[model samples]
Target: MAKDRFHPSSRGLSHHGMLPLFSHHPVVSEFHWDHSVWGSSWLFLIVSVLGYVISVQIVKMLLSFRRRPVPLGPIPALYNFGLLVASVVMFAGCLQSTMAEIAETRWLWQRSKTPFEWIICFPMGTRPAGRVFFWSYIFYLSKFYEFTGTFILLFQKQNLSSGHVIRNAMVVIMCFLWLQFAQSLQIFVLLSSTGLYITMYVYLSLCRMGYAPHFENALRYCQIAQYVSLLLASIVLIGLHYYKEGCSGMGAWLFGAFLDLSSLPFILVVNKQKKQRHVFNNTQKGSITSKTE
Candidate 1:
């Protein structure tokens, strides 16, 4: 969950010395993402990455010793289903809260459009640390559970490369960054990513059950689209951050932009490869059909 930038400052609290009940409360406050140990600290982030590496290695070593193929059994189903539920909940909760915020703060859209006006400008003002932030926290916490996906991949003996490790690790890092920064644009990303997760796991689960799912290409496109969207947003957000004042966590935004650039090319290449393979498969199928005819 993205922390409210107001939490650290005394101004964000109520004069009565108690937390307010509503999002509209001046002192009501959101989670402070940069608060010491948990948010933006190098110690926590480094330890987390190290722990991830060690734990994943341990699991892979243990699983590799097994002579038989690791039985997936009901685990993947349960994991995917649980993740689907989580994604759905986050999407719905975030969307509901965000919509309410938009309605309440009618200028939000105008602000969003004029990136230079507000991209990095909101730092825990009256913008209600509402449902969106709540679910964002949940999403952040959920990144831990995602390690199970890596474990599952290891169990299936998937290749483990530096790129794979970084990709998996980046999710944790990005989620942490998001919590600290609470960029408004991330709200859209959270919603869209959750929706994509739901769609992806639905097809994945179907395939696991022996269904000949055909949406693999579509899912890949969606995934690629996500990267592309983030890359574009990064450019705009970074540009706006330079000219605008009051946006919190410029460092985090810069780091995020670097990550966006790093990942975009890989995703684009994968998308291109997938497209070529699809076309080739279609061509082969057509040729076979003609021969039979």
Candidate 2:
């Protein structure tokens, strides 16, 4: 310049001066540890790690005291319940932040052009920011943890039957693949949100029926049925992935549908068999009384 122009450093446009990256493009700045989103995610990660450690210790202690290898039973129920609560909390926090962002957009004097707006609106095609990527990675890691627990139980021969081992193994594989898919930015929103809820409902229902807290013949049948359903659902998901231009819409719907349908027959068949057994017992008792009389 003929006269040295005094360019303010705040704009970060000076070729000779160094400025923080955020000053240049605040919307697309790299997420840092200090960011509130990353801060909360780190806290959740800590909580998840603590929960896993506590659960493993409790299971080990219980195993040591038992004469025969028994299912974790109530311990798994408690741990799953705690996990459900945590997921809900995290989901609520995300929703609250999204709402706040929407509120801020409404109050803005003019729509400021930013790359973040496009990224958020079209998440499937874009690489998410560091905070989102980190949290998604953590979620996938948690899924791996679930598979690890299932594998450990199966490998230890705690689950002896072929049905039990096969079922658990299939689920472990499904979770592993799902984790990969999630990290790839394939957003089957319904499946991601409701899959855990469906699983929890089925588990709670089985527990209520006295099948989970204690292993019963009915529980075995239920477990077998679930395995078959999951296999079928996985097949359907694969088909949908190819058919829907990789959108996963049909896959998500079918996954939920199959889970709901599969659980019904398990409960019905078990209860029907239980009722038949009860009727047979009562008839035998009556016959014995008649003979004595």
Candidate 3:
């Protein structure tokens, strides 16, 4: 049973405050990703992605005739703020739970290896039912909630704001695989991503409030830097997977790599679109200066 794997440690809590995160939570511990769950199927993935695309297309068609954006009235900012809180909590919980797992498990094997090594390469035979994995599961489920951001953007005629169907679906796929296989490298990726998300949600919220809209370029630049860094980490994991005692869920990681790589071009394209926000900001600044003069 899943309960057997997560019985509390005999030793006192390794990390002071983090013990409760994965320790005694019945929902977190007993969770499984098989047919027992609602969102655990290929059909769900296909239907969700297609459903979102179709709905967006319908809205776009309707709006083409009516052709005016609805005033969202603080909704967008609140949405971003909500996601910001989620990201922060996820990041902190995952980080703490992950460190606890490593601390507890390191002595069992490869006692000399650093925790960073484990992040890229989980020990073989790692199961999907542990404390660390609970966070991954939460991350997977969170994707559905995130779909709201896209729709909010859609209704306002900015549907592509920070999310779109392809990107959202890909996230669902990758996160699903991470939990399904208890894949190595996902923790690192998830942890790093939440950091980026914190920045992004803050940036988007400010923009929605009609402030710092011009700083999107800076956010994109940060994302590109993270992409490059994670890409390098992927290469390292691939190398370790081949050379060392194999890492758990590496096969899933391979599939995830393909999906992750596919996004590169999309990221590049969006970065290039620029939308002249930078130029528009500078022009506005000049106009204000002239009027003041």
Candidate 4:
């Protein structure tokens, strides 16, 4: 048997002596996704996204007349640090919940004919709420919070997140469906991005604070590795979905996989070009120093 019935473990953050994000509370337990819930409807999602996109473009157009970037004192640094902390909490909560889910289901894996299949495949009728999904809901809400990052960038010279409205909307949609259909592997993807978000934003915060060790190359490599790793996982999920019976939310998962496939090439090419530019800049500096010597 490659499947087992689903039931979540009863545990909380108090069990780990950490933050209260893991507690058994009404907010998480009473939580349920539905069309009736706020931001759950297609119209709401479209309007929210379009509102952000239009608002941001309007601000940019208005800001273009200004000669210089606005200086918001320490706001950007504070913002990065704040997200750094939130990323830690999110990463911890999601990871803790994910491990709990997997561990609770370990017995099924042990008896399954396809052991690995169970990791990415949940049996039918699994409830879409619990500790993990609680944290997942927090993550879903955080998408809206992150939209502010682009607006924050509006004060800057060349930050590029302003162009990511569609991308952000897709993420919000994917995460919504993840909760809506109780998709398998969503935790895995969430963990990957949250982990990488911490890493990238840690570096960003440090750079903002005048830190010495800024390994741009290493960071770029890490970013690329995450995309590649998730892409591989997506491929594996696709294979398991068709061959190993089925996984919940395969339709939604396919969209996510296609999104990854489409984006990976662009990132690879962009990183390559960035690396070349970095190398060229360093070489030019070295030649200038040599001539001075």
Candidate 5:
């Protein structure tokens, strides 16, 4: 009954696209979320990079002489909690859109019906846009807010790792590219990333509360897992692109390719560093044990 109620031809909501709950905004009609000039790809790239550079420099200078870490009483925890809540919302919204589109079909590895149809790709026009695209915009904006972490790290007197900067810059640029090209794979990206973030932030919040802090290693593994998933998914999409005539934003494939290539090495290096640290610690412990004996 619930399924039938939402059948695209339902009486009350049939006229408008998408579920009645999300029809109010007319995301497909009212707003051109991916407009040019004001929403151009170049603009997003330039602004995002400039913003990141300026923010990082300012924060670095502010913390230059401060030896002691700035005590951020509850801000980090609260901020992460807020981000966790938003990510959960994005995941749920994207899931609903995917379900609505596919109906009873398999949600994952689902086959395409038409020459241009695929689980990820939507039609050319935005009319009756689904919940997935709507949430993609939300996710794009959320990237800007993520830069706050740079400020937090600086204040905490932590080194700003290259991986962190590259990841943030890539996401910002990629999100902009998606908006420009109307990339379909973003739904998957959004869901997977947001899900990981929820797990990560929850663990972080717990650690902040003086809970199981040793699991930080697990979080690092999870972060690497995310990049691996991203790399694999990009490869899959490259294959899927050939299956159809083509999809909107297919040009963004180049961006996706570069991002995947760039991020993977960084993640692998981090993983390697962690392994080396662990081995060094064990060796030191053994040497001390022998000396004591």
Candidate 6:
């Protein structure tokens, strides 16, 4: 037998002999597409986008009403109410999801299993696990909402200075980018700690400068202090997390701490400063009238 011209296993060197472009390979098929998973992720993405848009628009409209000399009616109320409800719902969902991820990660870590392994293998790429991915997406959407709010404040000629604008913009952009790409818990915590500090500083500055109403100033100050304390606590917790659980765990902790500290001041301050300012003006008018008499 002529030494087999080619090993039996070696196919002839021909382009036509190459594997089919659309091989009916079972392994490839199974890995390529999973309808249920894809469908759910897609649906989540769609709802997220829609909710984000609605929230932004509502905020803009409400801010416009505040700035208008002749206030806009009924429509603004509807927008404001809708935006509030939507925001609360979205925030709740994000918190619930984040809590679930934390629990899962903790379980894996405690069991001496690789939690990051599941996260890494998720979505068949370096993409985070579903929980991480969803939360990260929500974080990005929240940043967009923040940016939109900032823009409205800028347009309304609100008390935000250039420094405030630059700082807040940087924080929001960094937050969005980090959540989208880094996905580490340590970085998340650090960013959040810094962001909350900056926010509190800016808000307090605005109150002190008389941008906010007088009665509200004290309350706003109190809120700023509270957030500052919270920021400090978060920073410490994040540091501990980094030491104990590596970067990813730290990141999740920081992200949460930042969010937790975000609205605390806003809620506490409300229009308290405005009320004080009104009282002061009344008192001043009375003094002037008494002098005139």
- Index of the highest-lDDT prediction: 3
Q: For model 3, what is the error of residue 167's alpha carbon versus the real structure, in angstroms, after optimal superposition?
A: 1.8
Candidate 2 lDDT tens digits, 1-293: 10111112222233436433322233322332233643235455445545545555566556666566555555556555655664554344333333333333323312432223321222222233332233333444445445344435633445233333333333333333332322221222322343444455456657755776544554456545555655554554554445433422233234434544545565566567777988999999999999999
Q: Provide the global lDDT of candidate 1 against the true structure.
A: 0.64
**Candidate 1 clash figure, as a count:** 7
Look at candidate 1 and tell me the lDDT of residue 119.
Answer: 30
Instruction: Please write out the lDDT profile of model 3 over residues 61-147, one tens digit for every residue.
Output: 777665677788878777788889988988987887776666555555445356777788876766677666777877887888887
Cα distance off (Å), candidate 4, residue 153? 1.8
Please, what are the lDDT tens digits per residue for candidate 5 over residues 1-293? 21222123333233344463433345521334444324446765797678797778877887888899999988887788889888887787767656554543233224434312444554333222345556776787788788887788888898678678767878888887776667756766788889888888888888778796687677777877877776776666666666654445767757876777787788778778878999999999999999999
Q: lDDT of all predictions, in order shown?
A: 0.64, 0.41, 0.74, 0.71, 0.66, 0.42
Model 3 error, position 95 (Å): 0.4
* TM-score of candidate 2 against the unseen true structure: 0.36
Candidate 5 weakest ten by summed lDDT: 1-10
TM-score per prediction, in order, is 0.71, 0.36, 0.83, 0.82, 0.76, 0.45
- Per-residue CA lDDT of model 6 for 97-163, tens digit only, reads 4344434334324453233332321111123323334434444445544545445453444554344
- Ten-residue stretch with the least lDDT total in model 1: 1-10
- Name every residue pair that clashes in candidate 1: 1-136, 1-137, 3-31, 4-31, 12-27, 13-27, 120-247
Clashing pairs in 3: 154-159
Those runs of model 6 whose alpha carbons end farther than 4 Å from true positions after fitting are 1-79, 102-105, 111-127, 146-160, 181-222, 249-283, 291-293
Model 5 misplaced regions, further than 4 Å: 1-31, 34-45, 103-117, 123-130, 213-232, 275-293
TM-score of 5: 0.76
**Reference-based TM-score, model 3:** 0.83
Question: In model 3, where do residues sit more than 4 Å from their true spots?
Answer: 1-8, 12-24, 159-163, 209-214, 275-293
What CA RMSD would candidate 5 show? Answer: 5.7
